[model samples]
Target: MSVALPACPSCQSEDVVKNGRTRHGKQNYKCRDCGRQFVENPQWRIISEETKGIIDRLLLEKLPLAGIARALQISELWLQQYVNQKYKLLEREVQVRPKPKSRLRVQMDELWSFVDHQGNKQWVWLALDAQTREIVGVHIGNRSAASAQALWQSMPPVYRQCAVIYSDFWSAYELVLPSKRHHAVGKETGKTSYIERFNCTLRQRISRLVRKTLSFSKKLDNHIGAIWLFIHHYNASLPANSSCPL
Candidate 1:
């Protein structure tokens, strides 16, 4: 009779030895090759990929953090951590993806949201490709020239050669954007109507962005993370008919 032994998880080596038992009474194994220890039948601390998919769907549905936790049978702290980690990765991916090759006509605008129970307001500055309906850049901070500049700088270099940038008559827009490309117009003139409608879509799809809602973020970090997640998902989910280079 032969007994089957499990391979080391760290190195996938058969050179593993019993190292006693874990606190939970699971059998512990140590890999001689890598000098790493792991427990057999270990309790998983990280969220599974299936749970991540559910989380992504719930986020798009504009569910509150607490509500999502309750629905998934997980702690709010765990869910928050998971979301932050995932969004940070998505942010890096977005930053490194290939930039659009052609020059773009863009629309820029800001939307308001509050963080913390103190009602400290934060502004979300967004730049959208007017023709493609794609989000090109995003910045979150106080409504000031610095935030506007950051938003403008966040845009891909390929988009900076814009034929015209339609924006409202916000002083920050004038201060941060180049004078030659900027076109500050009134909202009633339909210059920035596309971005304004996108703002409404954001509020409808992201619970934390909804005005006058109990789903507001209590921390600035979490608020920013939620925004990144929504932007990445939203851009990926756009219909082919509504995509770039119109």
Candidate 2:
């Protein structure tokens, strides 16, 4: 019986031979040409595909990295590396998606996040698409009108032209908003309730978003990238219309 040995992973040669058995009794092989030793199923190989899947989901979904590692019995470090690599690659082309240009009754709100800069806590602003429950944009420093303006500028041309922007009594919205769009900022208008409610959803889903935590981000840049990807997938999962069914 010819024992099945894969081509040398190191040299890609079929002229391979059985070298020995591992401590775990898995068959090990040797490359006749390169003389490099390897196993049909390398120890690292066991987690490679699984690690890729975990990282893919982490990059594409809103799940916590630690949670994914725990569920897959994979190392958190492995997932983090893949997540970071993909994050960097996508960041360049990860401009805002082309959403519907039609006017939306969208609710916009900002949340304060704590990030470390020179050992001091800095604030991060968050803006979300309430209807799809997607994070539209994020900014660093004070959640002021300037910050809001920057966030709006970062949005795709489609989102920038929202018919009506629903926000709380934050003066920043007034200063940053254009005269054409209805930027209502009052309690009775319930302008910001949509995003406020979505905040609860985020708090429940991820410990990182929990307001109680003094540290809100593991890495500020990576966290923002992760949030952007999450919103992309989250919006994808939403119903086609993205709002109450007609």
Candidate 3:
């Protein structure tokens, strides 16, 4: 009678020897041919659909990555990888309904935040539709005229051409927005109140955006992606009567 050993997972070689037991007491094998080590009948790790659903809900909350990991009983590394994957799949363009009405009112504002270090400042420029309270355009970058131009270009053509814009006395708005349609006003006047209020909503929901928080973003892409993810969810959750589908 002959005894057989399991093949190596990496090299698929049957020339394997029992090396030692894993910390969990699983039988571990080492392949002499490829120097590969693995266990037989290893239970492959899988993130269940139910677990993913929980993760999705958690991500929308103002929770830190480590906090979320601890709450879910999952490794932080796995949760980070999952979050990165979700960010990569996100669409860059904002999803918004088209409005045929001309002279729609728009409120614009910029939110201040930093990534990795406090010195590395990143500004989130936003445009909100006054009629439906939907975020219509967004740009993330330095507080400069170029970024303001990017925000202006991000909006649908209907807004760019016909909408009346209200913003704070930020010089960038004067440089980018159409002079005839743009109205730079003081916050006390409440012209840009909608966008300003939405900024508070973002900070409340996003941990990375919260001031003086330990849950800061390490990468700019992830930071932008997280904001976009929330914006998409926010837009989709709006009342059906509010959005005008194209």
Error of 2 at 226 (Å): 1.6
Give a tens-digit lDDT track for model 3, residues 166-212. Answer: 99989999998989999999989988887888999899999999998
Compose the digit string of candidate 2's lDDT tens values, residues 42-127. 54635677557656765453456777777777777876887787767655222333577776655666665555433434344556
TM-score of 3: 0.83
Candidate 2 Cα outliers beyond 4 Å, as residue runs: 1-34, 38-43, 46-51, 58-67, 91-103, 116-141, 179-184, 213-216
Q: Model 1, residue 121: displacement in angstroms?
A: 1.2
**Cα deviation of 220, candidate 2, in Å:** 1.6
lDDT of each: 0.81, 0.63, 0.90
Among these predictions, the greatest lDDT belongs to 3
Query: Per-candidate TM vs. native?
Result: 0.74, 0.66, 0.83
Per-prediction tally of clashes: 0, 0, 0
lDDT of 2: 0.63
TM-score of 2: 0.66
